[model samples]
Target chain A: MINAVKREIPEFIEGYGKVKPFMGAYANIGDVVKTSVKIKSVKPNDKKVLPSIKDALLKCGIKDGMTISFHHHLRNGDYVLNMVLDEIAKLGIKNLTVAASSIFPCHAPLVEHIKNGVVTKIYANYMSGPVAEAVSKGLLKYPAIMHTHGGRARAIESGDLHIDIAFIAAPTCDTYGNINGVEGKSACGSLGYAIPDAMYAEKVVAITDNLVDYPACPIEISQEYVDYVVVVDEIGDPKGIVSGTTRITRDPIGLRIAKLAAQLIDEVGLLKDGFSFQTGAGGTSLAVAAFVKDIMKKKNIKGSFAAGGITGYIVDMFEEGLFKALFDVQCFDLKAVESYKNNKAHQGMSASMYGNPHNKGAVVNNLDVMILGATEVDIDFNVNVTTGSNGIIIGGSGGHSDTAAGAKLAIVVTQLTKARLPIIVDRVTTVTTPGETIDAVVTERGIAINPRRQDLLEKLKDSNLPIFTIEELKNMAEKLTGVPEKIEFEDRIVAVVEYRDGTVIDVVRQVR
Target chain B: MKIVRPAKAGTMESNDIYIMVYPNENGNEIQLDSIVLKQFGNQIKKVIMDTLNELEVENALVVAKDRGALDYTIKARVETAIKRACE
Candidate 1:
C-alpha cells in the first residue's frame, strides 16, 4: 500500500511537465479529464436556507497565493468579483493574483486588496477605475499585464496563465455546473469571454444565485469543464449590466460629426444595398447609425449585416429591417442581450469569429463602413486611442485596428480639440491604428481626407463640404489649441499591440 | 442670405439652388430643394453626377419642422431653400 501511494506521487508530479514523455502526454489530454480516484471536491452548503458565499469559498480551498479569475460579463453590474474578493480578504489570503478577463469601475474594491497585499498582480485585457489610478500612482508592486481579447485566450491555451481557480459568476447554473448567461436574473449574454478561463483553469467554480434543475439547455460554458458549483443570493444588479448613455446624441456638434461621417460613406459611394457597417456605442457613432438608417430608409436599401460589440441602437436597426443580421461578439446592454437571444438575425460571435486576424474571413473583413473614435489623429492619419494628453494609458484599441483595416470606409469621428488639447498633431503619442488603414477623419472644425484617397477628394470637390488637407487640419487644430508637449519615455515594454491579422503593430512601454 | 457660385461649369451651377428649411427655431427640422432639378429632373441628375466627379460634396442645409411630407421630401426642401438663401 505504501509503495502504491509513493508511485502515485511521482505520477502526479509527472503530469505537470516533470518528465519529457509526461509533457508530451499531457498535451493531448483534455483540460478536464475524468478520474476514478475519490479526490475531495467542494460541494454546495445546503444547511442554510440562503447559503453564505464565505462558507462556499472556504469549501473550495481558496488559500494564499492562489490565482483566482472572474469574467467581465456583468461589466459594471458585477458584484460577484468584489463579494468573492471581500470574502477572500476576510479569510486572510495573501499574495494572490487576480486574473480577471477585464477590470471595470465596478471592480475598484480591488484597489483596497492591492493595498492590503492580498492581491499583488493583475492580468486582464482592460483595466480602469481606482485600480488603474492606483497602478498609475505606482501603488502595486508588480506591473499589470494588459492583453487584447485574443491575446488573453492565447496566453491561457499556451499555458502562460495557469489559473489555480476560476470563479465564474453565472447568471444561471445547473446542479452539475451547466451555465448560460441568456436566461438568468442578471442575464448579461454570451459567455464568450469566459469560455477559455472555464476550460483552462486548474479548478473551475461556478457561482450562481439562480440555480436551475439538472441539464441547463443551451449551455454556453459546459458542465464538463466546471469542477465545483456554489449557489448564492444576489449575484449582481441587472440594471448595472447596461450603460445609460447608449442613445443617439441630440447635441449639435456631435450631430454634425455624425452627419459628416455618414456623408463620407455616401460620398465614397458605399451607401448601397448589401453594404456592411460597424460603429461604436458612443453618442456620436449612434448618431451616425441614425443618419445611415435614414439614408437606407430613403433609398429602400438593405445591408448584408452589422457587426461588432452589439448595442441596443444597432439591434433596433436590425429589428427595423435596415440590416439583414447582427454578428454580435459581446452585448453592450440588456436590450442587446435580449435581441441576441430572441432575434434570429442577431447572432453571438467569438473573438476569433469577430476580429482575430488569424481567423478565416472575420466579420470585420466584410465591413463596408466603420465609424471609429480616436484620442488623437496625426497628419499621417495615424490614430492614438491608448494614451491621453499627459501620455498615460487611458484606453486601448478594443477593435480599432481590426475594423480600420477591414472596412472599406474607415471614418474617424472626433472633435478637433478635447479639453483644449489639439487632437490632430504632428505625431500621436502612441499609434493604435496605423495611417494606412484610416481613410478619412471627421472633426467639428473640418473634414480631412487622406491624400491616399484622391478619388474621394475629387468626388467631393464639386460638393460644398469644407474639405481640407490633413496638414491644414493639423495646423488649424494647433492654432486653436497650442501644440501639446511631447511625452518622454524610457524603453521597457509593458504591452504589445497586435493588429487584427496577428502581426505586431507596436509595443507600449512602461513610462519612466 | 447671399448666393455663392461654383467656380467651374458642369458643376452644381453657381445658381443651381439647393434649399434647406428646418421648422425648429434652432434649425432642428431640415428640408432640401433644388430649382435646377425642379425644372429639369434629368438635368439635376447630370449636375449631381458632374459635380460629384469634380468634388465630393456631402453638404446640406437643414430646415426643421416640416408638418409632414412623402417621398421627394429632402430633395424638394433642398432645392427651394437654396433658391431662397445664399448658404
Candidate 2:
C-alpha cells in the first residue's frame, strides 16, 4: 500500500499483522476500549512482598509467548529489564515480546536473548547501543516496532499492545507497594513512563532498592495499581539515572545552528510573558536552551513553564524565575531531580498528560516553541530520527512528532551533513515526523522555513539572519559534500516506525 | 615537504575522528579504523589522501580512529594534524 507520505508498505508484514500505512499527520486513529485484568486483592493486613525476581516471574505465570513490559526511567542505569529478562530466559520461556518504554546502551544483553529465541519481538519509543545495532542487523526473530511516547500510551490504553506483566523499577516503595521516585538513593525525579504500565498491565510489580516504611511519601505510582512489591539490593545507579549536568555544545557549527533557532523563536514572538518551551537534551538543542534563556533574561520576559524531559538547564531557568513552573515528565539530570523533589513549582506528570494526543489536553499543546534534533530532513521538511544515513535503526521518535504537531513553533536543528552524507536530501531514509507539522529547519548554513508557513517566511524576511528555501539548503550541502549515493535495502523488513497515531510511517528493511 | 614532528587532532567522542601524523620514510602511508567502515570507509580514506596531497606531505604516517565523523570534520582534523606535524 502507498501511504500519504509516499512510502510503499505491505498491507500485512509477516510478523506484524495487517499493517496500516500512515494516512496523514493528524488523521484520527479511532480508539479501542479495554477491559482490565480482574484482580482479587489480598487483605489489608496481608504481606505483599515477593522474595526474588524469579519468584515474581513465576507468580506472574511465566509462559511462552506472553508479553512483558518495562519502563526506562532509569535510562542507561536500568537493571530491571536485564534482571527480569535473565530470569525469564533461565526459566526457559521463549518467544516473549518485550515492550520497554526505551532501550539504552546498558541493555545490550538483550541481544543475547534475541539470539537464543528467548525473546522474539520488541516494542519501544527509543533504542540505542548494541541492542539497537543487533536489531538493525536483523538479529531478532520478529521485526521490532517503534512508537512515539504518546502512541505507546495510546496503544497500551487501547489494548493494542497488551502487557501480561509489567515490571516497574521504583526508586522508593513502601511495604504496601506505594512507589515514589524521590527520597531514594536512585531517585530519578518522575515515574511518568511507568504510570500507564502500572495502570493497564494485567499484573504490575514494583521493584525497589529503597524499601520504606508503610505509606511512602508522595506516591507517584499508587498502591492500588501495584499487584506485588519486590525489594532488591539496588534499583539503579543514581549517577547513571541522572547526569550531573547536560552541557551545551562548544562546536562553532552547532552553536551557530542553536543561535539561529533561538532567534527564530524570538522572531515568531514566542519569547514573551507566559511563554512555554521544550527542547531535547542533545548538545545543539541544549545550546538552544542557553541561547533562549539569555534572550528571555535580556528581554525581561518571564515564561509560564518549560516542558518535556526536564534538564538541569531548564531547572536553572526556573530557579532564576525565568519560568513560573516546570511540567516535568522525566528529569534528565541531578539538578532537575532535586527541583522535582523539592521545588513546589516543579510538577510531575504522567506520560499521557505529557504527549498523549488522545488526551483532553497534553502539556505539549501549550508549547510555544520546541527545539528538536533530526537525523535527516527532506525537501518536504519530513524529519527522520528513526534511522541513520544507511537506514539502520539508530533512534526513534520519542516526542519528536508529538511536539512537532502540538507546538506552535517546531524547529528542527541539525548539521547540514553528517559523516559525509547530507542531512538535507530529496527524501529521507525514513519519515519519522511528517513535513506538514514542522515549522523550520535551522542549520549552520542558513534557516529554511517550511513554505506552508508563509507567515514565518514574511516574519523572517526582514531579519538579519540568512534565510533560504529548503531546496537551496539541500543544494548548499551538496556543494560542500557531493550528493550521497542512494542506499540499497533487502526484501525483508527488520523494523517498523510508527507515527504518533500508530500508523506505520516507514519500515526499516534489512541492510544487505 | 616531509613531516618533521608528530602531532594529533580530534577526540574519541562519537561523531568525531582522532588523527595522529608522524614523520616517516614511507610515502603517504595510512592506517585507519572506523565504526562506519562498511558504508563510508572509502570516502574517509579518500578524504585523508586528498588532504595529505593538498598539503604536499609525501612522507608521513597517517593514523586515524573514526567514530562516524563526516567529511567536513574529517578534513578539518586532518588539516590541523598536518599543520602541527610540519611545525
Candidate 3:
C-alpha cells in the first residue's frame, strides 16, 4: 500500500503484523480517548522505598512478556536502563518488551538480551549505535516499533504502548517518591520525557542517585504517580546528558548553510516579535540557532517562546530576554538544567503536552519556525533521519515529524553532499518526515523551498539568496556526488517507522 | 612508480580516503572498507585503480579505507601513496 508520502508499504510486516499506512500530516486529528485502570489506595506510612531494583521488579509483579519503559533524558550517560535490564535478565524474565524512549551507543548490552530471547520486542523514538545495528540485522524476534516523540506520548496516553513498569531515572527523589532532574549529581534538567510513563504505567518506580528529604523541593514529578522509590549510587553521568558536539559549527561551509536558513526565516517574515522557535543540538543546527539569535538581537525582536529539548544556547536566548519563555520537554545540557532550576520561565513540559497530537494541544503547534537536520531529503521533500545510506538504523524521528507538522515554517538544514554522498535523493530509503509538512531545505550549495509552500516561494522569488527549485538542488548534488547505487536490503522487515499520528510511514528492512 | 617501501597517505577522518600501499608479489591488489561501500564502492575503486594505472604502479598493493571521499580525493590519495611506496 502506498502511504501519503507515496512510499509503498507492506500491508503486514513480518514480525510487526498489521500496518496502518500513513495518511497525511494532520490527517489523523480529532478527539482521542485515553484509558487507565490502575486503582490504588495507599495506607498511611506505607513503605514505598525498595531495597534494590530487583526488589522493585519483584514488587511491581514483573513477569514474562511484560512491557517496561525508560526515558532517555540522561542520554548516553544513563545507566538506569542497563542496570534494570541486567536485573530483569538475571531474574530469568523472557520475552519482555523494552519501551525505551530512545536508545544510545551506551546501551550496547541490549543486543545480547535481544539475542538471548529475553527481550523480543522493542519500542523507541530515537536510536543510534550497536542496538540499532543489531535490530537492522534482525536480531530481535519481533520487529522494533520506532515512533516519533509525539507518537510515543500519544501511544502511551492512548493505551497503545501499555507499559507494565516504568523505571524513571530520577536525578533526585524524596522518600515520598517526589522526583526532579535538577538537584542531583547526575542532574539532567527536565523530567518531561518520563512523565507520561509515570502517569499511565501500571507500576511507576523512581530510581534516584540523590535521595532527598521528604517533599523534594521544586518537584517535577510529584509523589502521587510514583509507586516505588529506589535509591542508587548514581542514576546517570551528567556529562552524558550532552549528546555529541553541541557547539556552533566552525566549518565555513556549515556556517554558510545555517546563515542561509536564518536569512530564509527572515525573508519569510517569521523572524519578528513573538516568534517561537526550536532547533536540534547538532553543530550545524546550533549554528542556525546562533544566527537566529544574532538576527533577533540585532532587530530587537522578542520571541514568544523557544521550545523542544532545551539546550544551553536556547537558555542563553531566554536569559537575554530574546524569548518570553522556554518550553523544555527535556534538557540537552547541564547549563540548561541549571537554568531550569533557577528561572521560572524556563518551564518543563511532558512529552504528551510537548508534541502529542491527541492531547489538549502541543507546544509544537505554537512554533513559528523550527530548524531541523536531515540525513537525506528527496525531491518530494520527504526527510529520512531514521536510517543511514547503508540501510542501517542509526537514528529515528524523535520530534522531527511532529514539529514539522506543527510549525509555520519547517526548515531542514544540512550539507549538500555529506561524506561524498548526495544529501538529496530521488526517493529516500525511509521517510521520517513527510514532505507536505516541510517548507524549505537549506544546504551549502543552495536553498530549496517546497513548491507546496507557494507563499514562501512568492516571498523569496526575487530575493538573491541562492533560491533554487528542489530539482535544481538535486541536480547540483548529483553533479558532485554521482547518482548512488541503491543499498540492497532483504525482504525481512526489521523495524517500522511510525509517524506522529501512529501510522507506518516506512519500514526498514534488514541489510543484505 | 616502482614498489620500494611501504607507505600510507591521508588521515582516518570524514571526507578523506586513507590509502596504504605495499610491495605485493600478487600484483596490484586492492582491499577496501568504507562507510559508503554500498553506494559508491565501485566508483571509489575505479578512481583508485585509474590513479594507480596513471602512475604506472603495476606491482603495488593498495589498501584503501574510504570514508566517502570524492573521486578526486580517492585519486589523489592513491597517487600520493604510490609515490611514497616508490621511495
DockQ scores of all models, one per candidate: 0.01, 0.28, 0.83
- Candidates by DockQ, descending order: 3, 2, 1
All models: lDDT?
0.68, 0.89, 0.91
TM-score of each: 0.71, 0.91, 0.97
**TM-score of candidate 2 to 2 decimals:** 0.91
Q: Where does model 1 exceed 4 Å of error?
A: A1-66, A157-162, A451-464, A487-512, B1-87
Model 2 DockQ (Cα-based): 0.28
lDDT of 2 at A483: 62
Between which residue pairs do clashes occur in model 2? A419-B70
> Tens digit of lDDT per residue, candidate 2, span A320-373?
999999988889998889889999899998888888877677788899998989
Q: A372-456 in candidate 3: lDDT tens per residue?
A: 9999999999999999888999999999999999999999999999998899999998999999999999999889999998898
Better candidate by TM-score, 2 or 3: 3
Measured by TM-score, the strongest candidate is 3
lDDT for position B71 in model 2? 84
lDDT for predicted candidate 3 compared with the true structure = 0.91
lDDT of 3 at A85: 94
